[model samples]
Target: MENRRSRRAAAAAVALITALLTLVGALTAPAAAAPPPLPYVHGGQTVPTYSYADAVRESVQVDTHLDSDHDGKPDTVAVDVVRPRTTTRVPVIMEASPYYSCCGRGNESQVKTYDQHGTILSMPLAYDNYFVPRGYAFVAVDLVGTNRSTGCGDVGGPAEIGSVEAVIDWLNGRGTARYRDGRTASPGWTTGRVGMIGKSWDGTLANGVAATGVPGLKTIVPVSGISSWYDYMRLDGVPRATDYPGWLASAVNGRPAGTCDAVQSDLNTAGDDATGDYNDFWAARDYVRDASKVRASVLIAHGLNDQNVFARNFSRWWDALAAHHVPRKLWLHQEGHTDPFDIDRGAWMTMLHRWFDYWLQGIHNGVMSGPKVRVERAPRQWQQQADYPAPGARPVRLGLGAGDGGAGTIDTGRGSGTVTLTDNPNLTETQAVGDPNTARADRAAFLATAFSGTTHLSGTPTVTLRFRSDKPDTELTAKLVDYGTAARDDYLANDLSGIENLATRSCWGESTADDSACYLDTTEIVRTTDYGVLSRGWTDAAHHTGLTRYTPVTPGRWYSITIRLQPQDQLLAAGHHLGLVLSLSDEENTTPSGTGANVTVDLTHSTLSLPVAGATHLGTATTAPRLTGTAPAAPATRSTPTRLLP
Candidate 1:
């Protein structure tokens, strides 16, 4: 009996030794170095401060030969701790990009990869370093593909966001083996809150991910972002006319088009997927624009001059969110598919800090207690209101008669005596004037073609009209202008008179010096006629083109169309009035080309349904002021902006 017991004890000893050996092996074995760290490159140089992509690369680190979940290929991802602000352990910000920024230079074809990654421009750009000192660790993700990471690039859906959520999971010490606690430290504290950010491509991704309502993600800053690729990129309610080729020339074709090509190709070839008439595919992607589902706090910034994406797009989202009682804020400026607030990138960084602070740090930095909106009043100024346009903008409607007589005759009733609409001005070049890439000195002249008069406009402007087309199809182009006088053609008092028009000065950030020092004498302000920087936006009416072209139309016919210009809060200098220029076109609105394509029109029979700021119709506040508190600190900001990141 004694011998048998001794033998049993020896067997137990052998089992214990084997277990110890396995433990030592795990500790001593060198884990593979993560996917070769993404080369810290930026603007043609290997930058160290740009080391924020490290955590991103680490989280999806690749191993051996294959994936375990039956995903076809081995997973390759890594997470680089993009330090936003300094701290022992700080909240994380996921910088979602369609394609990595390491490759954004123009291709020989003049094509840009940005349109596909437009969301990236919406987030905190290369300013991750700014967050490091403020107690946040910003991360730049390579998405599913486009870099060393694995998996195909999915725009904004379950797969891509699930990948991101996986990263969040790892931070909290879940599903990870490289940590002190047998698994990585899935701390309840750190991963309890996370924030999302992106511009354009990244912006859409951030907003999409927020829909998942991950426990850690509490806020998202979606700038110039699109909610639905199908709706925003193409198809407005009818079959698309293979319209925005820019999606291919500028968005895809460049470096490695990736999934963008798949999406765009699908559109280019989809003969039946034309307009979003019934909202089919659009309904699936437009989440935020239909809010009962979105509960996270949001800060939306948009580009007023964004004809491509259109500033008014945010309107759909704002209105929907308001209805659902979702907490939100906004900041719009005169920019094209980009951030105008970036004049002072730090200002962007500042906002990021505050947002993350409120949601992640649980700090009462006033972001949660601040106004519902803060907008940049154009013609050069900024304003803050508890809500957008402040409760008393008062909608004003001024009739746009059929004549260049400087006085738009009002037709209170229908068919007064003029041709209100027709088709003539159709070409794509208006979007190229200040377009840095193709701005011919001469092309600048034709841009302000029909631009004259200072018709006043406040708040958001939506033009409702009544008309009949002389043809089955007709096009309309409208530009909202702040009519101000030319700055001076003779160059008499030019500040750089000696050096010509080369006045070297950094001028982009928001300034509120009372217009006295920066006085824009709008009273005497008139169109520059040749080189005025008038703010404007446009929309095409192909969807509502009531059959005119290749078809038949009597001499005395009529049609109905509504051209809604982008919204604005521009301050018309005291004497300066807001104006709208309407004309006909025969082609797609692919280019921002100037007016005058020609068909014909009957002025007397036209009517316009515009909004004015009078006593009867100022959009009334639906409820008592929900905002009442002292102004908070100047919110956190981002980094340097413009072509002169100087």
Candidate 2:
């Protein structure tokens, strides 16, 4: 029995020694590290694993290389940041804007709120609340000369573009920044991947910044944004508004009065409202020219009826991006100057989430495998297509034929005659388009016979006119009209912005006491009018040759000019007629030249080009319609007067 006990004790000692050795190895040897907290993925989307309520909120001042305000110091832009609380690195979604403090953001006009320490307590939109918990950071940056940034507003010039570029550089560790207390600010927890997004001026900044080919910027979603400042202020060679740049700069600047007087003055001078010519000043702000340098993928959203920014901005940028073979997607809605979120919340959110996941988080969400374009064919009715200008669109040319009264015929065959109309600067568009058969002295109206089959128009229309003006200079307007009684999205209603806020509210993401994710619901304004304006074009007769320089027009000299109307995607039902109205001085969109010139058009030399989809010909018209008596006035609406500013 004693021998057995000794053997057991020896075995116990050996067992104890082995266990201690293992413990020491675990404590002293290189430990097997616990995996870092990674984002969770399910159904091809990043799930909310991080706590949004516990997200880190902070502010920093990014140092820009410009002294736009000329205060003997380098300019700085204000940046408000909200990030997940995890220690793991994450990508960023940024929106740089000039409207954060003054005009506010979104349908509810939510602005950033601050704590006593100047830290951001609440961000303007639901982007932070919705994206933070998904392991992504949301950043709101003030453009130069706006909000707390120390600089002058350059009105889409170098200073504004550079300021935004500086922030992206800082995120990638190539630029400098600091906290409110003057301590150095470092984005140590970020992976340096960024995706930008915004609407109006905010989205304009995104387009400008992405054109710089800035590193660390992965993608951008520019909604109703301008690609060229010159295009925004001028069409062809006619100024949309006088001193527009200065007025806009003053409107958005948060600094004290006279702080940016010199800058604003320079903006007005360089814009050259008198000549309305494209100069070096305008070239610097044209992002479409630099599209080849863009490395970030682009996702564009614009309203077909967005007169504020116009459809050409997105269409031109889309074409430039395609020329470079950049990864891209497009969303064209029916509402005017409105967000897709307000148009179709669920679908927009889903598409946005997937886009960010695939581009920013490197997730294979198959978003790129879907259609490249999604257009709202009708109110709340979306159609997916492979490309825009619809795959089979072809231009059909129709010759103008003078008929009895002011009305004329449009068909494949040309007619002989000279049509004359006097310039009336004070005439409104409503009066110009009224009763096409009335033989108005100030406008010439032409109509096509009822269509035998449904016809679709998917691109821009061009009108070529050989005409003579009695005066030295005149402003001309061309409009494409759809004459029918039908319910349509009232882009002309709701202050020309195409939406009305409802009393009810809807919540998007998690909320805090300081910031709620609920925003006022919005609905599309609808109106059933006898006729709808489909597209319009404006031009200065002196700019017939080029937009770069002004050529004086000699009285009685016939000039051939081509005007490109705004882009459109419309489906004309059978039995509906298409009409074209040519008039002088669109009082609604342009400042009248007041030349009062008598314009004469040779019908045989003028033609209208339509981008008809899936059709080789528009089919000839038999006769023009002439309705008697004055047309009925449109019903009264709650729409406010349209403004030039977005």
Candidate 3:
């Protein structure tokens, strides 16, 4: 009996010890790491599982190295942020812009709204509303000298770029910022990954900031942005407008009057509108020269008919990015100075969501495994291609041959003769190309025979002329026109970026009483015209030597000048003719020199280079016979201006 009781006690003690050990192990074994809060992805995209209506909103002031206003203090820019309510870190999408207070942003011209305590209540566009619910933060920054920021606007100068760079630095925890309540603001909620996006001036800032090779910027989407300020205001040393930089600075400056007057004066003096030359002032704002420093992936969007920013801005930047083998994608549409969201809302949103997911959140969404270029051939008609300049495009050179009257021929073989045309500053492009078959004294016209099949022109065109001017200096204009009756986007209209806003509204994400995610629906403007201008170029005769140097023209001295037209992608159907018109002082596009100098061209020395895709030659050229007495008057049509923006 004693042995049995001792064994039973011993077994009970062992069971008790085993239960205690198991309990201790359960208590100490590092509670199954609460699955780090992360963005949820499904169907190859980040899902909108977070609540947009309850996102946290805040504001901060970032310090910049520049004192553009001469206030003896460093400038500080305002940044408005919206993020998910979670405690975990998230990636950022920033838009640095000067138009927040001056011109507003997006299609509806929505500006930033603030509360009584100076906190941001609403952002300009739908970016915050759409992205915040998807576990991303949206930052709307006011460029220095605009809105609530302190400084003077310098256009695209160093001060502007410095302001944007400072914000990026702060987001990366490399710089300093302060809240409105004077508390130090730290970006502890961010993962230090950022993507910049905007349109117009906002997009321009993206290009500028990305060129700086900032540490945290992972990618950028520049929509209708300028690559070079010199190209924006001038073309090959020809001024587009006088006092443009100063005027633009004054227009966008939101500070007190007279505070930035000195800055405006400096802009006028440094821009050198009188000389129309590329100087140090322009070199500082040229982004193409610094493209090699870009470390971020770029997705560029531009309108093929964008006259305000122009197509060359994107093309030159695209070429520079290609030379460096940078990761890039392109979206080209038929609208003018517009956003892809306004063109194709559903597709743009999908691509943008997937793009951010892949680049910012490190999601394996396969966004980069497709064709690199998407172009809209017509209204609402899109086509994807491997690359631009259409894969197999090659330059086809044609020599100009003088014919009867002012009519001329462009063919493969050179012809011997001289053609003369007197400059008329008052003549418009419409008047110059009117009744092109008959020709006019104010302009010289060259024609190529109708295409036998569909032909594509996918790149920039160059016009080389060997001419002698009667005066010391003169201005010249070259235009490539497509002669056909087809329906096309009417990009020259004065409406909102070639889109008509409808009464019906569409919502993208969650909405609040003060800030709604709904926006007015839009439709593209279309017109069926008899002829359309494919590309236009202008130059000052004195700039024949180089863009930086201006040599006075010697009377009767032959000068060979080359004018490169804007980039284009067009499909010429069967029976469509291509024409080149040469005139002086394009009244529709440039500031007329009013020199009225007569120019004589040597037909044998002049040539036209066209980028034709999949074509060995342009078939043949035939000069139209001289008209009898009076050529038939051109049909009355609406005038199309080359530029529609101020």
- Winning model by TM-score: 2
Best by lDDT: 2
- Would you give me the overall lDDT of model 3? 0.84
Worst 10 residues of 1 by lDDT: 515-524
Backbone clashes, each candidate: 115, 0, 0
Better of 2 and 3 by TM-score: 2
User: Which model is ahead, 1 or 3, in terms of lDDT?
Assistant: 3
Clashing pairs in 3: none
- Score residue 457 of candidate 1 by CA lDDT: 38
Prediction 3 TM-score vs. true:
0.91
Candidate 3 residue spans exceeding 4 A from truth? 1-37, 625-646
Reference-based TM-score of each model: 0.62, 0.93, 0.91
Residue range 356-464, candidate 1, lDDT tens digits: 6667666666776767776654423456667765565665544434333222333233323343433333223233221212212121111111213333234566555
Q: Residue 28 of model 1: what lDDT?
A: 100
Tens digit per residue, CA lDDT, model 3, 456-498: 8888999999999999888888988777777778776644267
* Candidate with better TM-score, 1 vs 2: 2
What local lDDT score does residue 534 receive in model 3, on the 0 to 100 scale?
A: 83
Q: Each candidate: RMSD to true structure?
A: 15.7, 9.0, 8.0
Ranking by lDDT: 2, 3, 1
